[model samples]
Target chain A: MIINHPLLGPRDAQEFTYLGDASLISRPDAQDDNAAEKFHDYLYLRDNPAGLHRELWFHESGDRSWLVVTRNTVTHEITDVQLARDVARKEGRSK
Target chain B: MRYSGFKVIKEALTGHKGWTPQWRDPEPQSHYDFVIIGGGGHGLATAYYLAKEFGESRIAVLEKGWIGGGNVGRNTTIIRSNYLLDGNEPFYEFSLKLWEGLEQDFNYNAMVSQRGILNLVHTDAQRDAARRRGNAMILNGSDAELLDVEGVRKLYPFLNFDNARFPIKGGLLHRRGGTVRHDAVAWGYARGADMRGVDIIQNCEVTGFKIEDGTCLGVETTRGYIGAGKVGVSVAGSSSRVMEKAGMRLPMESHVLQAFVSEGLKPVLPGVITYGAGHFYCSQSDKGGLVFGGDIDGYNSYAQRGNMPVIEDVAEGGISLIPALGRVRLLRAWGGIMDMSMDGSPIIDKTHIDGLYFNGGWCYGGFKATPAAGWCFAHLLKTDTPHDTATAYRFDRFRTGHMIDEKGQGAQPNLH
Candidate 1:
């Protein structure tokens, strides 16, 4: 399950594509007043943690970008990866 | 106690000493009107249908580990309804008719085998999606045949049938689907919820919940704070870490999924087959071994253990469909987190907290929805509603877009 890809330096989490919980790119504000309960808790809540987490993968076989790794759902231990649009423009989640 | 051939020849003439211990570990009880939490096999068949079909007195279940330890002993034990959606073909044809009388209503042999299930079909759009899932499993009454390719070459005549790459042109059978004995369906629903007095407990571990203002009222385990007037859970893949200790967050993900087996031989799988192009599936095991599984490990994991390129892409989809399963041998493998859902189908509803009730996203099909997900999660924890074959397993159906999906694969929980 390698996945070292910040720019495809170590690949192979079987060529990516598992988009889950990187707080889903912080998706909310669908025009807010509890915009339909914050877009139904940003499309059905998550935080499925079992230790470290972070998630969202997608290299889809190589440089199609997306990354964000972090890992460790009970010792699958990756530690860190990145490029989910540079962690969504370093968390400010730029448009 | 009634398991007999004159009680196995009077316990083989006495040395057997009146066997027992099949259930009854008891212990945890500060309160209970129905706790549940996950002794697997849909939390001991929802505490054996909330005390044998809703008479729901006291009850309990709990188990953080034990009663056939999870994924009802790690699936691959197929079972089918063929399914082509309508929120999952009448809830897996009412859990394949409660796996056909489940050992005469849990009297407990748990070998409910029905012996059938095929699927094969190679392409022409997977034989028009297995003839529209065998005409939606014969319009949901559940029995489907659609065979051909000389009927799976007369029941699998050593498959790989001229495999110039995925050849076997026809399948989709069902015949009351098959396989059981997965940890004897968690010891026959923990011996029919301990002869209906319920309370199985064991190893325990819940770790949180007991909410107050938002409502829940019970849990927090590892053996303590057990109060519950309602609770429920059915924790497969720890349903987003047990509903995140009650703050709640789940569309679901968890993953893992492995499975495998092999070693023993001779009988060669005449029952479950599956493989339409990839993610394998198999059967056999009445000791002849084979078993099998495929896919899932496409990342997120609660880690039961897997990842050897999904065991070499499930032994290349079981040697491209039984090329004599590359001469057997493998013997063991495991894993089974799965919760999955976002539209793989399964939720079993009600959890705005008030007395909490959940069931779970049985992706990778929770051991063929164990007895109609414990008879519709014991009719939604004793009648809060939703049992007309799980009324589309609602938990707001992904906020009412109503996503039953049945592998149309959107909202990708690893592509369903």
Candidate 2:
């Protein structure tokens, strides 16, 4: 599987580590009353769709950047790839 | 129908007209006392045990596709209790014992072959680890033998023992551990469950869950909404997705694990053999096909297919261990979705939702744990408590720092 990284151009999927759904970056506020439950959901819950899915893949063997790859789980077709941090920032998620 | 030599002869004499479908394809009823969301081996076994042992009735196993079309039928078919951890060893040993009496218990021929399994050691540290694991197995009331280099060579003379990169130092042999007919296991369990009046509903896709005020009432499927007193989710790869409908998240990842089978040949592998230096394990099936598999795709996927790199990597491992395999033709390759848990151990426990239960995260051990998983899961559903053998497979283990990390991989799903 060739994952075309945003910065590293095209790289083999073997070099990356899978971190599962990209929704992980949108963690809830830690100060909320339901922070524990929210954190639990953030860490564990996944919308593992059978078709198109956005997942987090770390380029461990390349630039060390986490890439959010929009892929079809059924066909394994990669439609888009971007830095996970950039995607998180675009989605109004920040440290 | 009782399957026997006489029945076979009679059927043959009568042109095989006495045969019936192994299981009934019943329409989904409006409600059942127990609803199992997957018709794979574990789910069917759960239903079978619920009826046979727990004296429960009105059970139904719902499968999106045909039975045995999941990881239950896609594995290397090896069953072993050579685990090194307390959280996993006893449970697997129990499963092994169930496999021993499975044919008589189910009244069907499952081909539970206890040929043995050898984990080849390649280094001094590996030898020490194998010794520790063997000791653990013995402590758990299972057999384990540490075979020296000469013993390994005697059993498998065709191995690439003299190779410099990964020399064969010794091995850990579990004599009671071996392979079974993967599909036959599903069939036997389904037949047993069906005979016990458990409805096996196929082509029933569960689209959502019907949870009311923190209690599961039923499931909404493609066919329709079916009510249930309790629901058990045993969908291996789709555990995360299925549970999501109930507003629950699981600390598990779904990845595609590919397996391969070579063309038939003269019987070569006496039993199962696993490479110490790599993730390659293989055994010769009854039909003489060399069935083998390696690592997952290292990516989350619900797809039941794999790519070429993993295939090439598995082939490389096979060649590194058995140089003779280089000349053999690869007949077919397939994939199964592995429900890899954070701690590399399975969870068979009730969910936070009141009437919902879960039995998954079997990882690569799903097929081997089929019998005990079913039995223990049925016990949990019937009595609302974990079986003695599966007490450590609780959902709170991860949060409580009691992760049953058999491989000690430390939260890495792919590594496990």
Candidate 3:
């Protein structure tokens, strides 16, 4: 598998570290009334779809930047790649 | 027909003309007393136990594909209960015990070889950990032995004891642990269940759950809607997707684990061996192929194929431990989906939806737990309560912070 980095051309997937679904970026608020429930759902629950999935992959060997790669789980065909920081900043509202 | 030595002799004398199909291919009934999704080893065993042990009939095992096409046929076929935790050791030991009498009970030859398993301990810390695990296995009514270097050498003298990085210090041996004919397990249970009037429906894919008022009525399948009094989902790798139709998310990730088999050679490995310092294990199949495998691909994937790096890594680990493996040519490599759970343990419990139950998150070790998993899941489906051995595998454990973390990896699916 090759991840086409935004700054650095395409790189082998071995140079990167996987952290699973990108939805993990949206952590639950710790000070909420139902924080335990929310945190439990956040930590344990997953939408492990068999189709297209947006997941986080850190370029640990090259740029040390996290990228959200939208790839199909069935065929492993990558369709989109974006910096997770930009995606996080664009959706800046916190829980 | 009852299979016996007399029947074999009669058939042999008669030119084997009276043989019959192992299992019947039946159309799905409109409704069933119990509906088990996924016709893998666990699902078939569940139906078998439900009829034979629990005295419940009207059971149907629905398979998207044919039986023995899933993880049941893809695993490395190793079975052991050499565990270290209270929440796990007893359950696995129960599974091992069931494995002991499985062939006779199911009336089929699964080739339950109790050769044993040796877990190589490299560092001092690893040796201490193995010692504790062995003691735990012993206390759980499972056999375990702590073997010194010379003792391990006597068993197999071809280990790299002089390696500076990962020197062999000691080993833990589980005497009653070994391998079984994995594909035959699925067939045996299917036949046993079918003989007891359970429907074995193949080419039936469950698309959605027909739930009303938070109560599961049945499943919407490719064949048609089939109602059931109780629904049990034992889909291994597709746990998350299957439960999603019932509006439930699982505490698991779907990852791909690849296994390899080399060209057939004379019996080299007498039993299973696992490297404590590295992610590798090896055993010899009945066909003489060296069956071996390592870690998962360490990423979420629904694809049943893996990347090349993991293959290379596994080969490296194999040659590093047994340099003789470097000469053997690998014949085939295949991958299966693993529902890796948080805390690295399985979950077999009732869902919030009434009349619905789940049995998955088995990680990479579901093959060993097939017999007990079915027995316990059948018990739960029949009695509406978990079996005694599997009481700890509840959904509430993660919520109550009582996760059964055998590997001590907290909430990480890939690490386990």
Candidate 4:
């Protein structure tokens, strides 16, 4: 599989290590009242969709950056890619 | 017709005209006492046990595709009980025991071959770990034998014992562990269940669950709405998608694992062999094809096809262990998706919704757990309590701090 990285253009999937759903970036707040339950859901449960999915891939063998790759799980087609830092800022998790 | 020597002789005498279809293709009924989604090995086995053992009638195994069209027909066909953990060893050993008498119980020729499975040990630490695991298997009432370098060489003289990087130090062998004809298992169970008055409905995709006031009344399928007293799902990698229609997310991800078969050759592989340093296992089929597989592609995918990197890695592992495999030409390869649970173990328990039970998250090891998974799932659906051997396979295990993480890789589904 080839992942068209936002910065690196097209790269082989082997150059990146998969870390699964991009939703993992917004981990549950540990200070919530039902923190344990929320964290359990956050850590264990997943919206494992069969269609288009957004996931994280670490550029371990490349530039040592993280990317959010929106790809179709059914077809393995890359629809979009963005730096995870940019995605974190967009999701209000980064400055 | 009863299959026997007399039956075979009679059919031969009559030009083989007396053979009938093993199972019936009946239309979907409006209601059934129990509806099992996924007509793969586990679902069919569950229906068979529910009818034959649990004395339940009006059972129907609903499959979106035909029986044996899923992972049941897409695995390496190796069966073993050589597990390490207290929570896992008992369950798999029970499954292995069931596999011992499965053909006899189902009255079908599944070709249950007990050739053996040898897991190589490449280092001193691996030997110690294998020794501990062998002892654990023995303690759990399963057979396990630790063999030194010479012992392994005696069994298979062609291994790379003197490889500079990953020399073979020893191996752990489970004598009762071997291969069964993968597709025949599904056929036998479907036939047995059909004979016991359970409907095996294929081409009936479940689109949604009819949950009314927290009680699952039935399922909405492509065929139509079919009511059920209880609903049990064993849909392998499709578990998350199916459960999502019922408004539930799973503690799981789907990944594709590819299996390969090589050109037919003379009897080469005497038994199953696994590389200790890499994620590759191989067994020779009855037809002499070398059947093999490696790790799943480490990403979520519903696509039933694998990428080149994993295939290359598997080939590298196979050549590293058995260099002769490098000469053998591969005939075919196919991928099967697995529902990888966080703890690398399966979950078989009741969901929050009443009358809705689940059995999935088998990772890539579901084929080996077929019989016990069925029996325990049947027990759960009938009694509303976890089976004795499957008490640890609960959905609440993750929340209650009791994950049966055999690999010790924590909550990383792909890593497991």
Sequence-dependent TM-score of model 4? 0.99
Computed on alpha carbons, the lDDT of every model, listed in order, comes to 0.82, 0.91, 0.93, 0.94
Candidate 1 chain B weakest ten by summed lDDT = B407-416
Residues B292-350 of candidate 1 have per-residue lDDT tens digits of 88888866788799889889989988988887789788989988888887778888878
- lDDT string for model 4 (B1-416, tens) is 66888999999999999999999999989999999999999999999999988999899999998999999999999899999998899999999999999988999999999999999999999999999999999999999999999999999999889999999999999999999999999999999999999999999999999999999999999999999999999999999999999999999999998999999999988999999999999999999999999999889998999898999999999999999989999999899999999999999999999999999999999999999999999999999998889999999999999999999999998898
Interface RMSD of each: 5.7, 2.2, 0.7, 0.6
Off by more than 4 A, model 4: none
* DockQ score of the complex predicted as candidate 4: 0.92
Question: What digit string (tens of lDDT, one per residue) describes model 2 on residues B270-370?
Answer: 99999999889999999989999999987777788999989999999999999999999999999999998888899999999998999999887899999
TM-score of each: 0.36, 0.95, 0.98, 0.99
| TM-score between model 1 and native | 0.36
Candidate 3, pairs of clashing residues = none
Candidate 3: segments with Cα more than 4 A from true spot: A93-95
Model 4 fnat value: 0.91
User: Per-residue lDDT for B285-341 in model 3, tens only?
Assistant: 999999999999999888999999999999988888898998999999999999999
Candidate 1 vs candidate 3: which has greater TM-score?
3
The regions of model 2 sitting more than 4 angstroms off are: A23-45, A88-95
